[model samples]
Target: MPANTANVVAEYKDPADFYNLINSDEFSNDVGQMLKSFATARTVPGIYETDVSPKEVFTSPVSEIFRIKIHGDQAKETTARAEWENFTKTLNGKKVLSGVSINLEERLFLGIVGWESFEVSRLLNPFHWARKLKFTGSRKIP
Candidate 1:
């Protein structure tokens, strides 16, 4: 480290935000138990809010699934059309249960993500672009 040396840069958008629900000791404990349960199932686990809604569940259909509750200025300009296009292109062969967008009431403009009906159990992973990522959630609508 020298004068005028280059350093890592991280621009904080919302530094004053913290969630008591997820930050408390009780939450940590509960999360630990949840992880244990998940592990027992021997399946992958998605990040928090990874898949907000399950796909193709007409029993109790949901329009959207959100990962992060907050977002920056760039994501605000997006629309459901963009999502629809992506699903039609990317997840074309897969079964799509529903696709809807909802407001997180946070900083971000786009926090909603949808789940493909055939990929409902795939919520444990969402970043897999090509092919399949073996992951799913344990919530069956029916």
Candidate 2:
């Protein structure tokens, strides 16, 4: 079993800042290098033990997906919409779900009210937030 199996989620307050970072040359170059590394590894025989090739894992056409919803004043929303459109155009064939709304329920569900409350809740009932442990195979297979 892999010991480093954790996923991180990033939240950005401003849409333009997010777009700007992703569209920057540094970010683009890093992504390109990662894809190139995957492609290069596919050429090495017996490098990947799995059934799926590196190309299949990295170059899948349906991998890129973005869902963005902006909630703010009319002027801010309009500016964000225009920025999102420009960003999507650069993405080419990627799937993008875009919308603007001011739903209090949705905000309540997604937003973290306070770190203190979050930490206290987790401390009170750790199991409520903990992930279930998964075990595979009775013995190690070399």
Candidate 3:
């Protein structure tokens, strides 16, 4: 989201405008995470290939996903946090701990780091985490 872009999403409702937004590496990464998160939940490949526009966003809700235990002692906190949040919309401590299922069709959270990267494999079992998450609540770890 650009700082100067109109906050009124109704204004620039064109695919070209939305495509320009994809130029940001951050936005692309977020999309990638959303795809992966969708895969994790569905246990299948994703079907969609385009960005969801502001117009279509109101029609559906994204399924939530949680990946846990992803930081090492040497990692920077801000860097790690961005990777985590960028991968998914939900908060870090607010994990899907056994009931965050999606009957819909895809993912909303995504990542190349933090939870979905080397750090998480090093810290937790992917199978256990996947099976364990469902209906989750937030926790203040600090």
Candidate 4:
């Protein structure tokens, strides 16, 4: 196995259980660990501020909007966006994520490094983190 590779096994009875697991602190910590293991360190440290809240527009299938402001390194924005795209692509390959989607919008401020910033907005599906599964005869399935 590769140095950055590991296996995780989770058993959930239903969608709600899967949702709860994703929203749990334990799952967040696991994701953090995976990020630290697989992600490369930036040569220059960047400052970033992020906000996430329920999206006000569409209530039928409740969603969240994620906004981030990044400063110091312009390349960081590109790198961050690429990482997000890769993550979503991976998610799309999973059968559990059928109707989920992520929309990204970006804006760049042209000026001095200290004065300039990169803004990114992501419209997140309500079930972004949840893993939906169907199980039968003790066999786990997605």
| Highest TM-score scorer | 2
Q: Which of 1 and 4 is ahead in lDDT?
A: 1
Report how far off residue 32 is in candidate 3 (Å): 2.3
Q: Which lDDT values do the candidates have, in the order given?
A: 0.33, 0.32, 0.32, 0.30
RMSD of each: 14.8, 19.2, 17.0, 18.4
The 10 consecutive residues of candidate 3 with the worst lDDT sum are 133-142
Give candidate 4's total backbone clashes.
Answer: 0
Better of 2 and 3 by TM-score: 2
- Arrange candidates, best TM-score first: 2, 1, 4, 3
Q: Give the TM-score of candidate 1.
A: 0.26
TM-score of each: 0.26, 0.26, 0.20, 0.23
Model 4 regions more than 4 Å off: 1-60, 93-142
Where is the poorest 10-residue window by lDDT in model 4?
A: 109-118
Per-residue accuracy of model 4 over 13-125 as CA lDDT, tens digit each: 34466556657898779875665664566322111222211121222121122223334445745554544445456433321111111211233211111101111112323
Models sorted by lDDT, best on top: 1, 2, 3, 4
- Candidate 3, which segments miss by more than 4 Å at Cα? 1-12, 39-142
> Which residue pairs clash in candidate 2?
none
lDDT of 2 by residue, 26-115 (tens): 866986465464353343111112222223322322222122233334654455456545544544343333443223322110111111
